[model samples]
Every structure is written in C-alpha cells, then in structure tokens.
Target chain A: MSQSVNDLRVTRSQRFIREALIDLIEERGFDALSVGEITARAMVSRATFYRHYRDKYDLVEQIYAEAMQALFGAIAVQETVHSPQIWVTFFDHVAEYDRLYGALLGEKGSPWFVRKMRTSLINLIKEFGRAAPQWQSDSAHPISLYPAEDDLIPDVIATMFVEAITWWLEHGKPFPPQEMARRGVALVGAIFKETSTW
Target chain B: MSQSVNDLRVTRSQRFIREALIDLIEERGFDALSVGEITARAMVSRATFYRHYRDKYDLVEQIYAEAMQALFGAIAVQETVHSPQIWVTFFDHVAEYDRLYGALLGEKGSPWFVRKMRTSLINLIKEFGRAAPQWQSDSAHPISLYPAEDDLIPDVIATMFVEAITWWLEHGKPFPPQEMARRGVALVGAIFKETSTW
Candidate 1:
C-alpha cells in the first residue's frame, strides 16, 4: 500500500479501537473491561490493539481529550467573553458523546480521567484569562486581587466547571443539554457572586 | 466481665483497626495496602478485623462517614446560617485525616471511595436544602421551581464541594483549610450565580 493508504489504515484502526473501547465501557464498564473484548469488538487482533493504544485507560483518555478539544474549540470561537451559552454549547457537545462521558466520568469512572480533564480545562481557562479583558486587567479582574491565598484563579474556576460536568453526568443529565448549559452557567456565576471573601 | 467492660473491649478493638487502616493508608496508599497489613499494624487477628468490617473498603467508608459527622456536627452548632466558615471548618476537620483522604480521594484513590463519598455528600446537601429557608421556600427555592429537572440541586452542590476538596487534597492542601473553606463557598456561589437563566 502507498504511504497515504497506510496512514489512512492506521487512522481507521485507531478509531475502531477507540469506538470499541467506548461501546464496551458503556455496555459493561471501564473497570471490568479487557483487551480481548476491545479487540473482538473492533474486529482487530490483540497486536493491533496494542499498537494503537497503550491500555484501556489510555484509550479512555484519548477519546476524552479529543472530545474536549472539539467541544472547547467550538466554544472558544464564540467565547471572547464568558457567556452562559458556553455552558449550553459545551454540554450539548458533551451530549454527543453521552455514554462515553458517562462510562469514563461516572460513578465507576477513574480519577485519572478527571485529573486529565481538569488539567486540560485549567489550561483553557488560563488562556481565556490572558485573552479576556476582565481576567487580564487589574481593574476588571473579578477575583484575582487576593493573591496572598487565592492566586489559583484558573484552578478554582476550572475545577468548579469540571465538577459541574461530572455531577451532570452522574445524575443522568437531569436537564437537557441546553437547560444544563443554562443552570451550569448560573452555577458558575453563583460561585463567583455569593461569597466574595474567598 | 461486666457489660461496661465488654463495651470497652469492643471500642478498643474498633479503634485499633480504624487507626491502623489510617496509618497504613498514610504511610503508603489505600490501593496497595491490604487486610493482612492492617491486622498486623493494629495487632488484631484477621477474624477480628472481619468481625467489625466487611472489607478494607468498608473500614474506609466507616471512617469517612464518622469524620463527616463530626465535621458537620461541629459546624451545625454555629451554623444557624450556612456561612463560608463551614467550608473552612470542614476542610480543617478533613486535615485531621489528611493521609487517609489522600489515599482514598487523591491521584491514587479509588472510584469506589469517590462514589461512596459523592453519594454521602449528595445526601448531606439534600438535608441542607430541607433545613435552609432559601432552599425550602417554594417561591424562594433557587432551582426547585422546575421540580422534575431540579430535584438534584443539592446533588450538584454537594458534588462541586466534594470535588473541590479532592482537588485540594491532590494539590497538597495549598490554601490551608480555612482558605479552602472560603474559596469553596465562593466556588459554590459562582455556580449558583453565573448560569441563573436555567
């Protein structure tokens, strides 16, 4: 096969493994899953599975990280300012991978996944801080002044948002994506407005 | 022996196992630590350990539940209103079990423990809602107007709070307990405020 064809085959293999991993996890769970099952579902050999991914956790992380990039990339286009719509859009994107998120971040999900997501989110928030006027400027900054004990502005904000998503997933997504987006934005706002001392 | 002396023996046995579990978790981490080690450290037989706890996880959950009670109980006495101090006081209480929490909720923690903590916390938040006027009053209830979609008000709040503590523990308790309390209350407020349209 030509180089391009080989590259295409590699991409297809990766997608197959990732999708199989997702389906298996959603069906059974992340913890009880095995490589043989993933390979069987993907219609690939164990060697192919090993070549495409390091392990089940790595597969989960790969899917999660990609989904997050797309979700945030779409939102970042219109997110010059933080809006309630960001929650709406971000969650709507998540709902696209509903079962995947549920399996990886739910009651039986791993902390490794949460840790990866939080770190990714914190970076996004920091980028937002630099670009946004309110976060960037001394005068407009909302909660950046109390540097003695609260310099981790992005960490707190990212954690609050990520936890909100985790809670939404665990509770069966009680509200639709749009409503979740609305509640989510409000929830983030409440964290900011209710207690100023921190 | 008298009834009092029998009760004393039971108490002593329980303390030995609980303390041993904590010490072992702190010294190493929860996942690798075993029943054999816990028994050895506490100077109890495996049968005795089994008598008081179903497994290592049961022992961990028992400790967590007890800690939460003491933490919340202390706060409730001064908590006619839910103040930011509750966050401060709660984290301060958590500090007492620093290593155990690290083992159970940190990077090396288990999803089983997290699921248990989340469920317990959701209950606490529900209880808080029933008692708090803002959450109780039909007209005043923040998210309760849409009963079908919003029954999980306390669940989300409790999750956000729990996750924040998890992050704090993972990050080596950077802000100290009091400041953690303050930031925690603020983070919760922000969640409530920003996405109010929902």
Candidate 2:
C-alpha cells in the first residue's frame, strides 16, 4: 500500500478511538472506563490501540493539549482591543469541542482536567493584561494599585470565566457563542467597574 | 454514666470522625479513601464507625447536609437588602468550615460536592431575587426584563460567587471574610450593572 493510504487509515482509526473515548466518558465517566471497552466501542483491535497510544491517560493528555493549544491560538490571534468579538472567537473555539468539554467538565468530570483548564484560562487572562496595558489603565485604579490583600483578582476573574463557560456548556449553549461573548465582555467590564470602587 | 455524659461522648466522637474524613480527603482524593482509613485516622474502631453511620457515603452525606443547612440558615437570616454585611455573614459561615470547604472545593475535591454547592448557591441567589425586588429594581432595569436569550444572568452571578469562594479558601484566604465579602458584593453589582445595559 502507498504511504498516503497508510496515513489515511491511521487517521480514521484514531478518530474512531477518540470519539469512542469521549462518548464512553460522557456516559460512565473516565475512571470506570477501560482500554478494552474503548477499543470495543471503536471497533478497533487492542493491537491497533496499543500501536497508537500508551494508555487512556496518554490519549486524554494529548487530546487536551491539542484542544487547549487551539483555544489559546484562537484567543492569541484576536485584536488587542479586548472587544466582545474576541470573546466570540474564544467561545467559538470551545464550541468546536463542546462535547469533549462537556464530558470533561461535567459532574462526572476529572478534577485534574478542571485544574489544567483553569490554569490555561488564568494564563490567558494574564496574557490579556500584557497584550493590552490600557485594559488596566482604562479602570479608575489599575489592578496593581489594589493592596496586596486583593491580589487574587486575576484568579477571581479567571474562575468566574471558567465557571461561566462550564455553565454555558453544561446548559447546552442556550445562547450562540457570539451572544455569550457579548455578555462576557459586559460582565468583565462590570467586574472592573466594581473593583475600581475599592 | 449519666445521660449528659453519654451525649457529650457521642458529640466528641462524631466531631473526630468528621474532622478525620476532611483531613483524609484532603490528603487523598475521596474515591481512593476507605472507611477503615477514616476510622484509623479518627482513632476509632470500625464498630464505633458503624454505630454512627452506614458507610463513608453516609458520613459524607450527613456532613454535607448539616454544612449546607447551616449555610442556608446564615443566608436566610441576613438583612433582605443584600448588603456587603450579608456577604460577610455568608463568608463567615464558610470560614467556620473552611477546612471541609477547602477539601471539598480543592483539586482533589469531588465534582458531586461542587455541583451540590453550586445548586445551593443558585437557589440562594434566586431567593435574594424574591426577597429584594428592590435589589433588581434598583438597577435601571429589572432582571426579569432581560430577553430570554440572556436569562443566564443569575447563574453567571452564582458561579462567579462560587468560584470566588473556592479561590479564597484554596488560597488560604489572604483577606478577612469581611474583605472578601466586600469584593464579592462589588463584583455582583458590576455584573448586574452590565446586565442592565442590555
């Protein structure tokens, strides 16, 4: 067989395995699942599974790493003005993997995944701070001016965004990503408005 | 022994058992924990453990139930005006159980616990809406006036609060409950102010 044909076959098998893992996790959660079940669901042999990945943990880590990279890439390329459209781009990235996000962030989801995702989000917020100094200067008092006691502001804001995103995904995305992004910008502005009063 | 002595003994044992469970959960994630380790940590026998509760699940459920009941009680008795003092009172109640809150809301925490707590918080926010129509009315527009597409405002606010509380507890609470409460109220106000702009 030609090299291209082999690559196509490899891609197809991996897609099947990935989808099967996501569906199983959504149904029975990650811990109760097994490689045997994953292979069976994917209709691929255990030999094929072993050939591609080390184990479930390896597979999931790879998947999450890729998804997070895509998410950050989506955010990084946006305009530095910190507009609602940037939020739209972020949510749109999440929308592309809503099923994986829902399975990983649901009640049956892993705490490890949540922590990893939250750290990425916190970094994204910090990146926003770097990309747009005016974002802070726009406030009456810059975030840095707040006493050290209130240094958790970035964390607070990040957690808020994480929880809101979890809420949005868990609730089936009731509003379009664009609408959620619009509301997100407004909410951040409001949070800053309140913070400045201190 | 007198009846009063027996009651005191029972109270002490239960407290020890509860504290042991929290500490153990913090050390090791909940699912990996066992009744034997819990009793061993509490320095109590398995016989004593069974006398008070059915199993680990029963013990955790009872602990959470009591904690949540106390939390609602704290929120319920607050002044209906939704002042920063009310948030202080709420954080005070959480501070009283900061250990358990930390364990349950931490990276090793249970997702079930997070969901249960978030629901309770959402209910608390809804209660506030009913208790203080003036709270909503104080804004240029009432919460109910938002289009259905944006009806997730309450949920967004509740999640923000939960995430903030989790951050506070996880980070050793750099500020007093009063300070965190003050920040919380301001954040909520900002969210509402932005929502009203819609």
Quick one: best TM-score, which candidate? 2
Residues B22-139, candidate 1: write the lDDT tens digits.
6776677677788989999999899988877899988877788788888768877774545455556668877887776777876567757866777777765555545444432334
Model 2 sits at an interface RMSD, in angstroms, of 2.3
Q: For residues A1-198, what per-residue lDDT tens digits would candidate 1 score against the true structure?
A: 235666877888888887787777777777778899889999988998777578887777677778878886788788444555665777888778777777777655665676677787777665544444433233444445445334355566676566667767777776788876666444544443443333
**lDDT tens digits by residue: candidate 2, B11-125:** 8888899989988889997767889999899998888899989988789789989987887787778665455576788899889999888888777777567766777787666
Considering only chain B, what TM-score does candidate 2 achieve? Answer: 0.79
What shift in Å separates residue B72 of candidate 1 from its native position after superposition? Answer: 7.3
| Candidate 1, position A115, lDDT | 64
Error of 2 at A128 (Å): 1.5
- Per-residue lDDT, model 1, residue B159, is 57
The segments of candidate 2 whose C-alpha lies over 4 angstroms from its true place after superposition are A1-13, A30-36, A44-57, A72-84, A133-151, B1-13, B29-32, B44-57, B73-84, B134-151
